[model samples]
Target: MSIIGKCIGATVMAIAGASMAAGDPTGATASPQALALLGGLATAVSGNLAHEAYNKLGDKFGPLIFARYPEIDRNHHIIIALRLSHLDAVEAILRRFNESRSSDHDRERQEEAERVSELIKTYLREAKRFQGDTKGGRALEEREVLAALPKAFETALADRSGATPDVQAARHETEAQVLAELNRQIGSDLPPLFIRVFSGSESGQDGWYDLFVRAAASRLKDDEAFKSIWSAEQLSRIVHMLSLTAGKIDRVLDGQVIAAQDAERRHDEQIALQRRILETLSTEKGVPASELSPILERLLGHVDVPIADVPTVLANAVDGLLAKSKTLVAIHNDYPEIDRAINEARNKLKTLDIEGALTTIRSAQERQKELQKEQLRAEARLHFEEADILRPLYDHQGVIDALRRGIELDPEKYWQWCALGDEYVAIGERREALNTFNTALQVAQKFSGEREISVCYDRIGDMRQAGGDTAGALEAHQAGLEIARTLAERDPSNVDWQRDLSISHNKIGDIRKAGGDTAGALEAYQASLDIRKTLAER
Candidate 1:
């Protein structure tokens, strides 16, 4: 089996091995390719070769491979073998890729661990800074730790990533360690305010606002010396300022958390695309690396394209290949008779007959071009069929892009322009929507009939109303009503045009009412009611 094939088989086997160890049966039957790859791996040399194969697979597939097959013993064996083989370059690359793919939550766990360690160091430093002045230093030490306590608690409890059992345990361990040191250093010395704020069982209770409120209330009520130093008004001002500051801090933290989550989501999407590309390349049995490289490069480049556009972009690429294939088919049809002459020339070249060989070689070259063209045409047709199959799977943005392309291809199609305008409106790009509607209206004036012109004006009026331009909306509606009135007068039997005129009158009435012109509004509503009564009777 090929190296690529072996990688796929090994991946399946590795996953199956993990499942078996966990007392679960492999849920589905393995594919023939997977079985073959597995068989190849089993029959191959053990230690170095097996490890090298696994390393190459991991290098290509990244951390997702190890995550799926997380058997520690197997991982250890591979690492030992890799080291013995002295494949430092491969080892380093795989290590970097794996670390990059490891759960970001684990990294965040480590960060919390480091933060608590640093807090301990800082506390020790602060303790030593006032080593000899124990009487005065006690209050300063309590204040310093109180100020740092919120951050330490935040590190322990803030939602950094997925809080699995392991993550929770790690966080709890760090929180306990930090709290223990804090209690040991200043637990006895802390006032009732400090104990009330930080002694809660939950980490989130250590927030500065809660701490400030409790501390202030305690000092104001119990400490008569504290009361003599400050007025009630002064205390109220301090609490108010603290509340405002805490509120601002909470908003900034919320924004940062949201931005971080969005970044992580994008990163996961990119990793998924990479895994798909790797899996696809591994499964293609006989495709040469040279031929595959360009396809792989293009797929990698497209990883950054918005997910909605990927399907359409891929389909269009296939269409381009199909067009090239059609050109080849035409060439093949024009050169049907050159093959036999080329074969004869090749036979003469064996006898050192240079002139005959040259003539036959030229004929053969022409025939080869024709054959190549035929092959390309066949491949192109297959690609075209595949693209068609994938068309329905494209998303809303893909559909919009395709529609826009269609409009560009047939610029004179006023209806397509109108359709694109509507799509733009659906997506909330009001500026683009208005521009598209105006463009459609311009085209309608030259190539379309009065109904199309009336529809354009109606759509423009709606957009203006949505934008809060009541006067502009009224003007556009009036223009549409004028066209509708003309069309209705020209063809009295056209109910659609008459209905449109009534709609315009109602819209004008709404605008007049909103602008506080009750008399004008009443007249417009009366006109609309008259049209509706006439239509209802008909």
Candidate 2:
């Protein structure tokens, strides 16, 4: 824009800023609002003036003024820097000129240039182009043009300037067109991936989209198409990553719910188990055992529970029918055997085996049979208590079995796969354990549960090794290790990954040994051991 045009535009912006800053009754905070409005108006006016100058005086005239002034040449530099939307540059120029304290004319000129530079810089900064075919964007280096005004004004703004009209219009039109096209490209792209590829239960990611847009625009320095396509591609990657992340998050959330449910189930079972044992220990009329005691005892971890607190269902337990809360604080300490007897009596309660229990109790007095008799009494009592309490859980066998069955029915469900794998671990069933891990992996590949995926692969390697497919097992283990490595790199700060990586390395080492690659195996073991040591210290 011409020096005259900028002055006119600045005047209009100043008027608007003054009015708003005067405190209109609308209650909007005035300073920022005025600043914002002033910046916008100034940019618009400058744009119009530049367009006009491009049309009237040709591209080179009144567009610059004080830039050419010999004494004011430095201010022109400040002007251009400001035009480039660099406030720091403008401030820097002001500091240099203002501190010099030269003649009044120089100071006045410097101040005017600084004010103009500041307003333009502020607008350019606020007008950051984050999206469009322009990608990293192309802003008018308007400050550059204005900065030239001090020097160039002598010739360009002269009454009979030497520049031509056609040349000027062409330059302005082309530059404006490029900037507009870039923005257009960005707003038009990116919708297809947003809709089709993202389907997690909780999937609304506008902020992510915004970041992609900024990155895309940043890449568009040379060509519009490149930036536009770059943005679209980035958008796709972000969506895919988000989908994977969301799926993993859901798995954890689901697991938490299942954990709570399982704990509740166990606690209820324990209570039922204990109640039956209690009922069985009571004698035929109302008498308790003369010197009652059961050798076999089940102990849950200690808890800080209030003695007066009502029995509440616990969240986790063993032996489906044990009453952890009741047994802990509520039980009588003086008659400690009462607790043991009650537990022992439950095993035989369902069988109505009063005769057997009495005989077992008598045998406890004999030195040779003392421990044996107590063990028998305890087992018998447990069986009776378990029988009745087991009914409800057994009744839901269809669902439990269904889940169990599904674990095999589809190897892809990590929850199911992990379940069957755990069962195999308990029974020393290596073959089944290997099979279960395979099932786990099938489901895991479709999502981002790398922890379980690594587990499944490790098990597969183990199975393959047992079956004498040593090379194949080694390959599988290596693949698992590679997967862990990739996950760790992607999330560099995840501490748990250290352990996961270590375990994977150990598996790799073992696989290498089985394949007759002793050296490789040693390296793998060393790596795993090192990671393990680090984790231990942490």
Candidate 3:
């Protein structure tokens, strides 16, 4: 029934209400707290009150709370909460709190004496003896009769100092109880003020690379440690890794937002995320905000700026995260459960089968890497040096659909387009396959002379072969072989290029033999054999 608690509980009730309206939850409303926790998980944020006091606290605790209540994420109700933060509405909250008081102290509700002002104004028309203002946690702990007295109170019919015994005694007891609660709150409920902010540009490590290596290089000049360790290549790798993680988070978020396949389960993942963050924040040992690095402050505070003059509003966020991130990282390193969850979820995506070990992103990268290797072996098994492999987890059409989505998100990811071309082949849509391959070709051409582009030509040949155009297929194969040969010539010492040329030659020989050109086939085969044998020696 507390206002700040309403921020957490109300949000949960709202979700439960929504779930009830949508359909019956097997266990919803069975335990309101359980359901409420689900709502928190769906939101995956820290306590609103904590966030109002410290930005990092929200980031750290939101996840922690959800983790404590795994059921919340599975049945979470807020799809947009992830994009919003407690700080987003802190101003309104402050204003609302200030407005609620009648001619009293500051809006923050500090001090038991000030709470008396509101009590006299609201609970009694005129408490002639009332003075000062007070409210909140510290106010409620009072055991005195005066603690019960509201801002408003009835005026004494006569001066209490001159009243009869009965009247004097009544006022005395009332004042005693009223003062008790107020005095209690003064010592209890009040928390230090701070602010919490959220940012998704990328994780902290990625932010470090971008700000230092790309956006503003000047900042790096002062840090000899960073400068000594910096390199364009290393920075690029960092950026790339950050980008991949960001994408993974985004993709999982997208899938969860859509509530795809047991949508409730997505809530569970978020709950886990929140719980982990909290456990991290609560346990970490943090330095003073002013003493920390500027970037570190920005990341921990979830904002960007100098820390010397922390705004009352921003201070809450800055303080919380400073203490939170360390706790989150420390506890999480010992438990790779999140990793297991994500991998399982991605496996579900890969197979379109969300069964055991699916519906979670337990080891997606590992699975993807494994798939990439599988695809590599499949292509290597083929005679074409640059064979493109497209293995869609869903149906051929579904593969196309997923590819379309992937392309829309990142046109630079040509490999997915090449993957989509597989569906065209499966459905006997050679023309579509050819056109898709051509699109892949265009994307690859952007990175000209790359082995990927050479593979595109192999795709073209596959399209020709599928279309029963042996002559065109043969021509495509020969052209690909020529490109591979030229690339090998340009890098005589490069074994990969040499291998590529060999593969192409083997394919050309296969095509010639299929065409009854035995003599030509023997020559090409022998030459390929000789080249491969020589490369093996070197």
Which structure among the candidates has the greatest lDDT?
A: 1
User: For residues 1-538, could you state the per-residue lDDT of candidate 2 as single tens digits?
Assistant: 5556554343232222222223221233224333232222222333344444433443343234333233333222222322332223323333333333233333345465455435534543554332211112222344223322211111211212333223224333433343233224233321222221111112332222122222222222232222222234433433342333333334434565698799999989876765544344434323232212121121222345431221222212112222321343335776555445554554543333444544544433343344555555455444334433533564333433444544333334475555556556555677777777776788787754777777778778877887788888887887888888888778857777777788888888877776679999899999989877776776
Query: Number of the top candidate by TM-score?
Result: 1
Residue 53's C-alpha lDDT in candidate 3?
A: 22
- Candidate with the larger TM-score of 1 and 2: 1
Sorted on TM-score, highest at the top, how do the candidates line up?
1, 3, 2
**For candidate 1, what is the lDDT?**
0.50
TM-score for each of the candidates: 0.28, 0.25, 0.27
- What are the Cα lDDT values of the candidates? 0.50, 0.44, 0.45
Q: List ranges where model 1 is wrong by over 4 Å.
A: 1-395
For model 1, the run of ten residues with the poorest summed lDDT: 39-48
- What is the C-alpha lDDT profile of model 1 across 425-521, one tens digit per residue? 8778888888888898999999899889988888888889889988898898899889888988888677887898888889889889988999999
